[model samples]
Target: MLPGTLRAALAALVPLVALAVVPPAAAAPAPEPVAPSAAPVAPAAPVTWTMQPSSAEGPDGRVSLRHVLDPGASVADHVTVANLGEAPATFLVHVGDGTVSPAGDFDVLPVDEGPRDGGAWVTLGDVEGAERLGPGSLRVSVPAASAVTVPLTIAVPADARPGDHPAGVVAELVDAGPSRVRFAARVGVRVHLRVAGEVTARLVADDVRARWQPSWNPFSPGTVRVTYALVNSGDVRLGARGTVSASGPFGAGATHRDADRREVLPGGSAQEVVDLPAWPLLRTGVRVHVAPTVVGEDAVDARLEATAVEVTAWTPPWSQLALLALVAALLVAVRALRRRAARRVQARIDAAVVAATTPPARPAPPASSPPAPRPSSPPAAPRPDVVPRVTEP
Candidate 1:
């Protein structure tokens, strides 16, 4: 009923009033501002490092430090430590005595044990603040992705023994701080220093012992077990390969077994055992032959010789013997039984023949005709007497 312009204005006002009353549909909670999704976090990296024999020119591709000198000689060398981690690392550089492990691998003594022999003669040069660590070792800091080279010296005493003195330079990583559990990593390069003097190479076999294990099967042969020790009695390291052989008297049923090659250090020995299949000869003779050779990459000026030792073992064939005895006993029993049966049969046949050949005894003649005649005379008298009585009846 109002004008069109006023009505249009009123209609627009009505919509505004309705929106205000409804509170603009609660503004949809502002969509929580969508909180911008967070980016993923990455894991931290591990620390690592390496140590190698190096020179001023940087890692010269040398695996170890080898030197041959006189009794009072001295030598100089360098080792580089590389920090391949994201932070700076400190390392301990020291010299240690080297020895051959039971597994034949070259190893160094523990750092805390220090060193003797050739290791005692070697010294590591000082680094920044090295006075805190003493004379034989050095502590140096290497920056991340960088390397530090340390110098070392080996001064042999005039009274040093004349032979090979094994030692090595070791680099150990220092922990960042005190912790409930500590882990330390170390690496080293071997130092093979030979003092000028006589170098002898000798390898021998000792404590040669053998045992024959007989098989239970009578038709199969048995095995011989040979055990011996390989001794390095000389001043140099030696590697050896050997053979174990067994034979009966006069070289009968000879068999041989090969032993694996092994390395032994000076004054060291290794025990070896081998089994060789052989025939069971009442007595078996076993011999061990070991051939010695030089070990290590270094050239040695010495003579290597082969050595041997012998032993004997008793390998009796008890099964075969028992079988033979059983057979013989059975055979004797059977023979005795056969003989007894033959004797019994012969006696029976003799009795049967005697019974068939011997004539039956003739019936004994009536021993007495007298007995019969007495009866007949009695009867005739009775009859004559009775005849007169019968006539009256």
Candidate 2:
């Protein structure tokens, strides 16, 4: 009660402690709610696709890629569509460049036939829906779990450039409703416009360094592997027979497998494979030789010169075996002949018993002992006479 100043200080401290204990519940600073912006959703990017066609048409399950178009075509063409997608997606292919006409975006434009050397357009349908596709072409659409191919045909302009023209074809892969896989195929189209006016025959050589299939050989019976290259120089396809000759101890022999016949397009190269019998030939150590025409009609008007090939022939392991067999057989025959001769001598000895056992014959002894028998009879008479004489004495 005496310390008034201490009471004032204590009162101030009491208020401070009360404030620390009870003041915290006052509207807990309006809890800041999380701003919805933390989980912002993103927009989806667009889906694009490309188409790759094959050299030929194929059935379902197989990807048909073949698509032909004119270089100067300006028509609206369609291509057979194939479904290679896992889900349903809308597909449209279109042609650009001069192939597109004034008819519309994917309209029909009258153009000349054949290629103009300058590349042209061939739309499947459109990205969404395109027009003015190339000639001899079409578009295709594949359904979810199904497939369909549509025809695509167009025309080429009469006045176009010459040589080769190139273009790019696109196949858009999409998921209409957003599905698992998105497949797109693209084709790189090349238009060869009759090579300007015309080009002469050309010659190309490949696999020039000749090599044997086995790379080695023996004269024994076996096959000689040979491979060569064939290039068509003329404007037309060339199908002719050519030969590769081998010279060895056997003889000079050659064979031609397939001669790029029937379909060797100009400026195209084909591989030639031949299987030659390693039997006896004109010489030993296979040598290189060529004979262009063996037998058959020349596919092209131009005559062909035989292409030479490097060859190798191995020694005949089989000949060695044959010689060895002959020697062994001769040895066995000689031994058998000697044994037979010895057997004959022994058999002759066994058959001749008389010559071995009989003593040598001698002349008769005559009557050397014949006289003894007569003397014995005289003794009886002599005895009688002797008895009479003893009585008288």
Best by the TM-score measure: 1
- The top-ranked prediction according to lDDT is 1
Clashing pairs in 1: none
Off by over 4 Å in 2: 1-193, 203-205, 208-220, 231-258, 261-268, 282-393
After the best TM-score superposition of candidate 1, give how far the Cα of residue 381 lies from its true spot, in angstroms. Answer: 41
lDDT of 1: 0.81
TM-score of each: 0.65, 0.36
lDDT of 2 at 2: 50
- Cα lDDT tens digits, model 2, 287-331, are 334333312222323445555445455534455466678899999
Model 1 misplacement above 4 A: 1-48, 85-92, 129-135, 138-144, 173-185, 217-221, 260-262, 318-393
| lDDT (tens digit, per residue) of candidate 1 on 1-393 | 899999999988998888778844444454445677789866444557777888865788988888888889898887888889888777887788887775667878877887877789888876554433755677878789988777788898898766678888877888776576767588888888878787888888999999888887778888888888888888776788888999999999999988855577677788888998878889999989999876668566788889888889999998778778889999999999999999999999999999999999988777654545444444534555455545564
Error of 2 at 157 (Å): 15
